[model samples]
Target: MTIRLRLAALCAAALVLTGCGAVITSPDQVTPEVYVEQPSVSPAAAKRFGDDKAEQAYQEVTKFALEQAFPEAFLDPAKKTYTAAELTAGVAPHLTPTAAQGWSSLVTLALAGDADAQDSLRILQFYNVDDPGSELPPDGDVLVRQQITDATVDVEEPSGDSPERLLVSFRHEAVLAYAEAGRPYELDVTKTMSYWLAPAGANAGSTWLIASYDGRMDVAVDS
Candidate 1:
């Protein structure tokens, strides 16, 4: 069988063995419970932004990190396990298959309601850079700083008695960091991602949903 076919089969087998139910379920079913509400920012602090839009943007930013960025970063083998090339060549296919074996492990994870898988999907759906810069970090000790500079949203007005719909645009900045061996270094990276919240209707709750998220890093250095 071709690589694509083999990958697909593996995915299908995994799904069956894991009892994930469906290969392409909606996001609502997969999202964790923690992302349902706005994050806390003190009223006095929030007033510095001076607008409801800013408040909404802040909420969306935190929500994206928790519900989308964290999960994607955790489960993505390119980011976590394999190199980027291996991911493209060895694991890119198998989203669908003619036989039961055609499902990929990522698909299985996604269908199985794995929180990490859900987060990965959320990040791809929401966070993207128009021009992704170089992946390599600079040589020598250096600290990187990143921040979000701008954002915008298009909200659809609710009909008769429905909730609003939302479309968002976000932007950010990043600074590279480099350090010598046996030296301590700190780097801070900020990201901004947008989201589209469909109007709340009878079937709306069944649509893509993100409830909450927590971000943590497990760091290990290899010699």
Candidate 2:
């Protein structure tokens, strides 16, 4: 007998082959493989600047911010909740102190079941990964995974009123895949966001931190 399995993920404009197939004669012959796709950055934004140094910087910061702020879906079916500290720490490295504090409060309110907070953070969409009500399968691991399919990072130079400030924007398309009983289910998501960044300290070598942000995210799921 021959068995074939293929897992593909989109990274920017390139297609990434995440998992390969294996031929098995017996059911117990091989262990099942879990599909995972980490976020990826595109070079399209860097091309806008027309500078090699700027291109490198854009890719570096964009990837760093994505990993720090918007992480992939949770693959562990046993986990259900996130603490305020956990959520805050996940975003602290890329945000200013005040921004981090605000995010902490947001998570606190969401954890308490505040409807508005939940809506603002949009956590309930994929929170219950193991819910059977969604007609999830019972035999294999029920996991939720995400792939950053396409992404762009744009930078705006400081001018006029905000002479020293820099604006960085990230726009990305992602696919959220839910594997229920080992079957892949998918959803489409797109997010556009901008961050106002300033130096964390007065020193020239000080790192830039996100002071404020505005963004929108839309998810497309079956009706």
Candidate 3:
């Protein structure tokens, strides 16, 4: 994997494998993986700015994270039902077999209309808007911005010594979304998200995806 950066996201590109956990089978009986291509590192990279494998892994991971971070598919005002294929598109790629095992198990429950998944979706409502068109896509959806305050890449030891994880991180302000009044809604002016990525396998060509994430957005505001 290689490390590359973009305007916030557009990270993970294409990879050979799919599914972070288990194969997701929707009630509609359409396998999400069919519409998705194999996971690969994202393109239009930062241009030889960082380690190849780590940057590539970061691209792969952040792209998926930004996609899933959106509250759109899950919190549309129409209460639109996200097809398993669409809902699972950005997440499935770039997952390691080990991560996929646990991921699939949890996502399977979510796809099955599980309460937990529903609850997870509910949390994203704060980012939701009845009208997405209120703001331009670029302004509302700056996945990778020039605002990264800090970044670091760590390549794990091979030979199964240190779990062979590729960790990349970015410390940046949280990008918020637009709401009904046509104004940007930033809940926390001081909040920032710390992103982390890990490789899906031990080999040099092993793909990457977000294995862990930690951030905070606790601001006193009226939503």
Candidate 4:
């Protein structure tokens, strides 16, 4: 569902769709919203990471969390979508209950054509059933050509949300393919996204799970 994030992990399954009787040849037309929340920064990355150990801890925890969740989270099939329970079950052990619940919301958005989905497998993308910015062919089946490259990661200070929180950001360079009025087009973009994680338990040694994620794609694929 996370066409974008899944794009990074190479784990999304929403490639070519058949059986609905429609051939999709176009990418969704996006509408820009004036107000999108910025990724929350509690103490600012540099200020908090002033301590090298804290910075290292965040990086280690992020890697550990991904190792635990990604293996299970990135298994969506092209014809099948993941349920909230399934998603939570895969990553909840590394995250808070609320974050676990919220993971489902991210999937819902991805299924609905939100570009903000988490990193996964697969390269092709399609529009969700709803979402104004998305345009799909009849029968809702589509095939996409997309490429995401140059992925980089950075660890920031803890989120301001509570005593224990950390934010990790992923950056990528992408070439998105789509169609408009039966013509082919490609968008060169830079996408920056992040995840906020919290300590699994009350202890410093506890594992971490993503609490929230914020994504922004800085290129327009509009009509």
Candidate 5:
């Protein structure tokens, strides 16, 4: 039988069971890839605002934001560590300065091993088998993949026959598998993310940049 691990209750459970009996180990010089399910515009959205160029831009921005926020994607697989500067610089092209600044504290906290912060960032991967009867623990490499679906873009502000600010939302699901280990385990996670985008300059045709972002972790059930 598979048990679902809820990150929301991790901290309190950490106190009771030695933090789920799983140690966060740094992997080798191999960056695990996240398989992203490409964003698809709903039929309703296409009918409402059929701007393919803007839709593609929104999708690119969303993908970038997701990758930067995901620890498995940003961490230096070679060194098994990451720097705030690297994170900031990587996101500079896609996110506004203010938005990048807002992510600083969260990134700092997650790197510092803050459980709550990691949960809030939707990057925590450690799992524990609460059942005492479970077999051995996983002891091999880590593999992670995330899928995006039901993506839709909404024109929040239409200024004088032009789309000004756009809101993009999508559902994110991830499966972190440790199949090669002793008693292999996997963590299935689901999250919803939203991004607010606007032109970087006053000109309506300027490059699009993410102005704000929000994410929420949904309850994950074992498959």
Candidate 6:
């Protein structure tokens, strides 16, 4: 059977055995690869707003803000908005107030499409995860830095064969290690994240969000 078929079967089996013993898949089991491509931004828009550098910065910041503010299961039922208070409460106990403020600032700038927003967002995205207490290198970076693994951009043509809509896919993986105070140990994890970006508002700016993420804990050792 095809990998996609196998994966679908696996998912169905998982649902069926929801309350039963653990479902198992062998190492040789096939898995399908997913790909998403990024669409090209209009040259006129790029020139009027800013260069590639500016756009990249904006995307980075927005991603950071969304990641920090929108934790798992924090979506408001009525409005479907991710509450800032819920985010602050969950992270505040573990991070310094300054750090929290930094995260908030990153999100704000990203929403505004500011150039400097990306750098700030990048920092927050690196650290906000299942484990936040990991110590970093001497420079205090928590995420493993790696090159882009997969990317694709999809452009849709309008009814009259005119290019009107665009979709960008970005995916990457990183190795991260960190240690915490009070605990005599260090932890390592490998994480992969992907996002999709599309034009936002009636203007040239773009809005993006997390499409998916897979995180796995590797090891914990005494520091």
TM-score to true structure, per model: 0.30, 0.54, 0.47, 0.38, 0.55, 0.31
Lowest summed lDDT window (length 10), candidate 5: 16-25
Question: For residues 173-211, could you state the per-residue lDDT of candidate 1 as single tens digits?
Answer: 233242334343333333444443432225432322222
**Candidate 4: TM-score?**
0.38
lDDT of 5 by residue, 91-148 (tens): 5556566555545665576679776755544432222222343332253233355555
lDDT of 4 at 85: 57
Segments in model 6 whose C-alpha atoms lie over 4 Å from true places: 1-139, 156-165, 180-196, 202-223
Residue pairs clashing in model 2 are none
Show where candidate 2 strays beyond 4 Å: 1-57, 69-78, 122-164, 180-183, 202-206
Clashes of 5: 0
Q: After superposition, how far is residue 211 of candidate 3 from its true place, in Å?
A: 4.6
lDDT of 6 by residue, 145-166 (tens): 2222333334334447322333
- Model 4 spans > 4 angstroms off: 1-53, 57-78, 104-165, 173-190, 202-206, 217-223
lDDT accuracy of residue 183 in candidate 6: 45
Best by lDDT: 5
Write candidate 4's Cα lDDT for 97-147 as tens digits: 665444455555555655635332112112222232333333322322222
Ranking the candidates on lDDT from highest down gives: 5, 2, 3, 4, 6, 1
Which parts of model 1 have CA positions greater than 4 angstroms off?
1-54, 66-143, 157-164, 176-193, 198-223
For candidate 2, write residues 10-98 as lDDT tens digits: 11122111001222223343332221122232354345443454434444445544354334434344557777666555555665665
TM-score of 3: 0.47
**RMSD of candidate 1 to true structure, Å:** 16.3
The best candidate by TM-score is: 5
* Candidate 3 lDDT over residue span 117-221, tens digit each: 433332211233334444433344422211233445554344543344444554433334334455544322222343345545555244655543334333332
Cα-based lDDT at residue 108, candidate 3: 55
- Model 6 vs truth, CA RMSD: 16.5
Ten-residue region with minimum lDDT total, candidate 3: 10-19
Poorest 10 consecutive residues by lDDT, candidate 1: 1-10
